[model samples]
Target: MNLSICVLPMHEHLIKVAVVGHPSEGKSSVIATLAERDDIRISARSPETRECHSYDIQVGNQTLLELIDTPGFQRPREACAEFKLYEERIGTDNIAATFLAEHGQDPRFDAERKILTPLAEGAGLIYVVDASRPISKDDRHEVEILRLTGRPRLAVINAKADESTHMDAWYALLNSTFNLVRPFNAHRASFAERMDLLRALGQLEKSWQTDIDAIIAAFQVDWQARMDECAEAILDCIEAIVLLRVAKTCNADDRREKERVAQQVADSYREKCAKRERECHQAIRRAFKHQLFDPAPVTELQHGLLDEETWRLLGLNSRQLRRALMMTGAALGLTADVALAGVSLGVGTGTGAAAGYLMGRYAMQPLSMLRAHTRKDSWLSRSMRREIYLGPARNLQIVFVLLDRALGCAHLARNWTHARRDHESIMVTRPTAATKEWSQVDRDAISRYHVAILKGSSEQVYERRTAVRELLVKLLAS
Candidate 1:
């Protein structure tokens, strides 16, 4: 989402936090999760990062926070020994700056210098450790080094797996030296957990409290705006697919030609609907800040939209389908009654309701488009010209199916963390229909919206679209 609101003034200090740790301790993963950035490279291989990189959390033109991903400490014991000796010799508390002054250009201390550059420059520290592993002497040395830097520090125990057998040991050691310690799973951190981590940053320094709160607020607002745009995209996709129609001019003398055109129109309608749905899902992914990963492949998603499993899993049940159909048909009947000046004494309403019930019973059948019919192009033409029409879908099941699929996409986009790189594991599965849990009011709103689209009433469409969009925004928020 391109956040345009200038939440902070240009003169405000850009909060800088350095993510530092031992080699292969999930420092990069932590940064990736916190920055909401998947472009940051994360690997299980040792010494993957050889240099420092910066990621800025910005809204519009203003930078809110700057997270520096520094190279992991390769010689923490040696660095700690040197720092202790220097502090003893100089009788000073500013050991980090003094060490950098002496060894900033030394080749042997390249990694150490790079790691301490941000700390010496007054950046807050987020030290990551693999809590799933046993504590080592080097880990202690690393903790001592950060303690001597005198920067406000937050220790993050990034447990790579579900195993927390060594968590208590790590926490005990971290609590003595760090201002705050928290266990954050980089691979599976939720939106709320990420926010909690930000709040913890606010507590590290009293001077940083207001800035941290403002950054958190900006992030919340940015996320909500993304969801609102997603809601708009979903609504637009539904309208496009629901009102979709295809046509072709056919010859008057050729019956076989007309049949061929009808078949072509059907194919076109399916292809167009599938394509539009894919585009909408992609838009949702972008809104959630997904740039490198896709929940599923394009062909897989396109075929899955109308696949049998998707229909069975996501389409509305018999009872719900009946209610939706009856509601829509009753509205249509009311329109007809108004046209007839109420002369048909409630007959239209009864017939429409019965028809709706019958259609509902058959709604779960195989997907099919409305039968193609031909109409004269114009009466003034010299020769009779006919046009064949193919859609505005006949089966109401497609509406429910499409909605469920869009919701599933939004769900994955919002919840999929950037630290996850295993493509197969992140691939989209047939999601349970979230609409099954929606209340009657929600269902009624959808039905009315569908009716509005079908009737092609511009004013009714505007009102109903607003209602449905508001419903979707609430759902996505939850």
Candidate 2:
């Protein structure tokens, strides 16, 4: 089954903790105990987990905690052979196994060489020991192996219900050998006990707190960066659609031919845009998979095609959409008849922005010619006689008009301006340093967004964009 993974934006306040121990030591059970969730399967036998498993735990609406479970450590002799085999196959020695194989030859070091794999994955060791047996050299060796991982670790003394003696020796050895130590009954571990264990983990290393903080901060920064990129991609798609539309309306010699060409452009543009959207989605999802909240829903928007729901979802109200449509129609005029042809060409070329602009220009030519005639009545007959020359002129006028409108619409949408005020807002603020910065950011973000779209799905790209936008807004506000 395909797992639907939502990537969580990097936050400045999240923690990722891994639970690791030797086989048959209740590593999975500890996770179940800590999470208070029965989703993880537990077993009394060894080697239950063969690969890594990750779980996201929510501490609050905005706070997330991640836990990774790793494969059980193997016996020293078996581990060395596995290491040699793995090294030969992969063309590189496995780091964990190398450490174990080097140390496993000594008879006194067998237990110490066993718990290497779990240690290598940066899992702070939760060395589980059965308190039923007397303190032995083997347990001491295991502690030595965990220390080799060079991570902050905790020792969990699993006291079998019946035997509780020899606690002093265990405590003494732990104090001298391990980083932190605690007692946990896997079968009867309570929530309070789990919280205490986490608290101990928090204090295991003096620098762990800082590392967790850094990871969160990185997440937030990355998320904002991605959103800006997605917004730019959306604009690119719109621009292409507009350019194609203008081209179809102005350039086609015959009506049917014009319609056919436009349709081709539109289809090509749609496929390219769809591909881009997918890439953006996958990148964002991967980045934010560990977050607490689900990301904003992703919706695929087809270039130059507006369904009622899509229009509404663009954050435009019904009246605003109607106005935009009216403006588009007016701008399109007789050119609307050639829209299908233009769409086709746009889709074929996979260049929606250029096609849309071209179609928009084609539609605007007649209006420009009419206006020119009204202004120069003395030249009316001559202009009428020169109607044949109007094709190129009409095309140019359509191009300019469409370019202006498409860009204006993009700006208004990103700036969160309502449709009624969009025209007035255009060119209202003189381009400044802040505007330039925003523009650059938008450009960079869009380029990255396009890369992501090309790699994944529309929904995936949209989600990444949303996360990025949210992060940027938050950062700017701060």
- Top-lDDT candidate index: 1
Best model per TM-score = 1
lDDT of 1: 0.79
TM-scores of all predicted structures: 0.89, 0.34
lDDT of 1 by residue, 178-297 (tens): 999998989889888998999999999987777677777787888889889999999999888877888898886688998888778767776888899988989999888888777546
Q: Which residue pairs collide, candidate 1?
A: none
lDDT of 2 by residue, 1-478 (tens): 0112234344544455556555656676666555444446565545666666766654224435566665554453444454455556653433565555566575543443434444554445566766666875545545554554456677888775567678888788777767888998765653345546666766776545553333334434544554455444434443343333112222334555445554554454445534544443333333323122111122332322222333222322233223332333333342432332322333444233333344444333233221211112235444322111111122222222222223333332323211011233333432111212234344334333333343336775676556545534443333
* Model 2, TM vs. native: 0.34
Superposition TM-score, candidate 1 onto the true structure: 0.89
